[model samples]
Target: MSSFDAEALERAAKAARELESSKHVKAAVELSKREQNVKVREYDARKAEASADAEKAKAAQIQIAAEERRKTIAFERKAKEELMSRQQQMERQRMREQDQLSRQREQDMLEAKKQADMERDARRLQMEQQIQEERLEGARRRAEAERANIRARAMAEAEGRILEQRKNEDIHARDIQRRSEAKAAELRGAIQEAFSQLSSTLGSYIKDSTALRNTVFVGTALAVGVYGVREGSRVIGRVVERRLLTPALVRETSRTAGTFGLRQRMKRALGMLPAEEVGLDGIVLEDKLSSRIVETASATTNTRRNGAPFRHMLFYGPPGTGKTMVAKRLARTSGLDYAVMSGGDIGPLGKDGVTELHKLLDWGETSKRGLLLFIDEADAFLSSRSRSAMSEDHRNALNALLYRTGEASRSLMLVLATNRPGDLDAAVTDRVDDAVLFGLPDAAGREALVRVYFEKFVVRAGEDAPRRLMGLLPAARASKIEIGEGFTDEYFAELAARTAGFSGRAISKLMLGVQGAVYGRGEPTLTLEIMEDVVQRKLAEFDERRRLAKTDYTDSASEAVTGTAADAAARRSSA
Candidate 1:
């Protein structure tokens, strides 16, 4: 409390003490209490009066708020009515404007139609005037042409009269010349008759003499005999050379029996023939090797077309690796006649090998289309001269070949295939312009080969209506061969994995064995079991051959060492 309130409280306390001390203290205290009570009642009356004033002010604010809300509603209603009146007016204006536009479009269409009709009439009038002008021009041209034709006819008549006069003069001169020639001919004929009579008398006199007749007959007979003998000998020699000398040397050839002439041209045009110098589909090989062959074939074909000398090639690899096949195919693809010869045949010719070799080359040169001379197993005869086994005759034969092929030839392309390239003489290898290695088929190549042979010997060969395959298979025995569905690409892949180090030819043989086993069992169906059996047998055979080959090689090596040791002992003893 403030200081004033504390003072009042102290005074009240003093008064109460005084009242207690005085005899009228009770009345004084009571009067003081009454005054305090009266003050409290007055304070309460003031608070009540303030509350009543606050309530009146609150009621006045509520009345004012209700009036304001009612005015706001009235204002919103008026604004809404105004907005509706403006929207209705705008809608009516849009409808009137649209009607005006429609009327304007109809009027425009009518105007455009009227304009089009006017333009069409003008165009028709213009066209009629132009046609009339063209007709007048044509009439003027026709009249001029008639005049020109009459002038030309008059000129031609004048020229004809002049030419007729000249022809008459020429004819008179020719007649006079012919009369003179006839007279001269008469004189000549008289002289010729006299000479003919004189010659006839001499011929008659000679015919009457027996001695002259006999001499003439003998001379004629001798001449006829000598000429006949010479010509006969030449013809016989050529026949013998071609028929006997070269036939033994040649192992195979498509030169004599091949697609040729019009038939070959027709087949080529129809896309029936193989691609030209691009790839060989007849034989299968790795892509890289195949591409190289295609390049070589293309080059060879281009060289031939350009009249360049043929390039000699060497194909050296393991046996049955398609060396011979590739050579033959390349020759055909390059438009050259193919001739396959075995080098082994040359060694047996001995002293006559040179003559036979020459004959073969001469015959090859006779091919109208150039020849591709493929020598298989070339090392058989063309081995290194340094070897002791090379006899004089063989050396002579090799020399003959070297001399013949010393220079590039346009008529003959030499392709030598050998299992042992190292054994070839340097001279022989030197003649080669290109060399290719035919390796054993890899997994992919073997798989492809298996698929091919399977299709050929197993599938096609078992067909009911088997046809000739490029004249390779002449006849087919139709067998009801049933192959299992399980025999798929995976099976072939597995077979390829099993047949490691197999050559293409070996795979073909393996398939052929599968066919044989099926036929031998008298079963129409060829199952996986039968094929596996044949494969196993073929594998065993192949292993046995490999083992024998290794054994033979080892034995030869040991013998050579032993022989060298023995020779050294003998030399030491001699010393």
Candidate 2:
């Protein structure tokens, strides 16, 4: 009913049960009641003591809060006083600064006024001095002007007197010059008259003397005859050198044989001529071969520059292997004049071969630069002397060549080309300084050649193509050749493989065949089939030629064997 705790109620019930079970039940109940009252008193005392401690702590907290508030108020009051004191001090400093600035301004104004007054006084003094100086200068200038006028008048009078005297002297000199000229004219007239009389007397004597007139006529005729012969011989010598010394077998040359016309000169200057004609542009060879050739060319250039004897060379190769082409290029690169001759041409000359050969050598001797004498088919005439087929005239011609080439010549370089190097005379072989071999093209070289020729003949076949047939016509009208999509570098490599045994000239001819085949077609397009047909035809032709050449060689060998047997039988019969 009073909202007592359950624990206290349970403790009362337990005490009542214990008293009911006890014998002294009234006493147990009275003791439990006393214990409960005592415990209640203790609990009240502890609660009162805790309330008193909390009140004391609350009072202590109130006192601490009051102290902190008082300290905050005192600090705020001190800060306010400090701020006022600083503001008052700043006001005093401002006032003092204003007073100092006013004093400085007053001083500056006083100094400025004093400087202005001093400048004004100085200007006044300067003006007075300038005026005094100007007065003195004006007086001095007036005196100088008066004196200058007087002196000018005196000088004018002196110049006038001198001028008059010079004029009189000039007049006297003119009179003397006139007299001298008149005397000189009279003397000249007398001298002319004397010369005229003397000429007339001499003319009359010359007209009367027949012997003297004959002598004069003869002397004049002799002089004219001498001059005519000298001029004629010079002209003939040039004609011989140009026409006769240069042999007919010279298929092409880079030397300036005669004068070039203006148009030709313009074309050369504009680079219209083929680069191969002037340099080593179109030549294709193996690297090692080309290197050796270049070394020889450098040696030749050095030899020529040093004024040393020109070295003779031999180019041994199969037919159409570029020996002749290299010879032409060598002459140009060596800075030497070139003259090409065929050795076979000497045989037909009979007795005149020696004379003609001599003339060629003599013409070579006259070259300011050395002459490169390129003899193609050299073995045709310069064969071994042990052969019985050699004619007397041929032998004599060979002897003449041997004699001329025995010693190194400063004016002549001998370059011999031959397919049959073994057929060449030992004497001719001995004269060679450098020997170059032109082997067949290898696979890579053949590939390169294939590309080069294809570009020239197919890709570039147009009006830009080189002129042919003595340079009188174009090789093609326009680019009518078309390469197929299948025609690539691999195709060209296959083509090179097909043309394994072909020489450079043979390859060129094969391309020419390709061109012709294209032109023969209606559309003039180079299809793969057309190229194959042309290549097959050329290959067949090449095989036929090779077979024919082999047969000919065999027949010649048999004929020689039979002829030898016949000669032996004849000799035995005579014995």
lDDT against the true structure, each candidate: 0.81, 0.81
For all predicted structures, in order, the TM-scores are 0.54, 0.54
Show model 2 residue runs off by greater than 4 Å.
1-251, 257-267, 270-272, 275-279, 465-476, 550-575
Q: Count the backbone clashes (under 3 Å) in each candidate.
A: 0, 0
Q: What is candidate 2's lDDT per residue for 1-575, written digit by digit as tens?
A: 67759998999999888768889988866899999999999999999999999999999999999999999999999999999999999999999999999999998997798689879989999999999999999999999999999999999999999999887997889999999999999999999999999999889878778878888899999999999999999999877665434544444444554455355555555555554464557788989989888888899999999998777777876688799888888888888878888888999899989988887777677677788988999999899999999999999999999999877788899998877776777777666766677878888888888888888888778747666554656566775577767788899899999988788999988888888889888877888888887898799889998877742112332233234434543544475
TM-score of model number 1: 0.54
lDDT of 1 by residue, 85-190 (tens): 9999999999999999999999899779867986998899999999999999999899899989999999999999989978798888999999999999999999
Model 2: per-residue Cα lDDT at residue 195: 100
Model 1: residues >4 Å from true position, as ranges?
Answer: 1-216, 219-227, 230-247, 257-278, 462-476, 550-575
Worst 10 residues of 1 by lDDT: 551-560
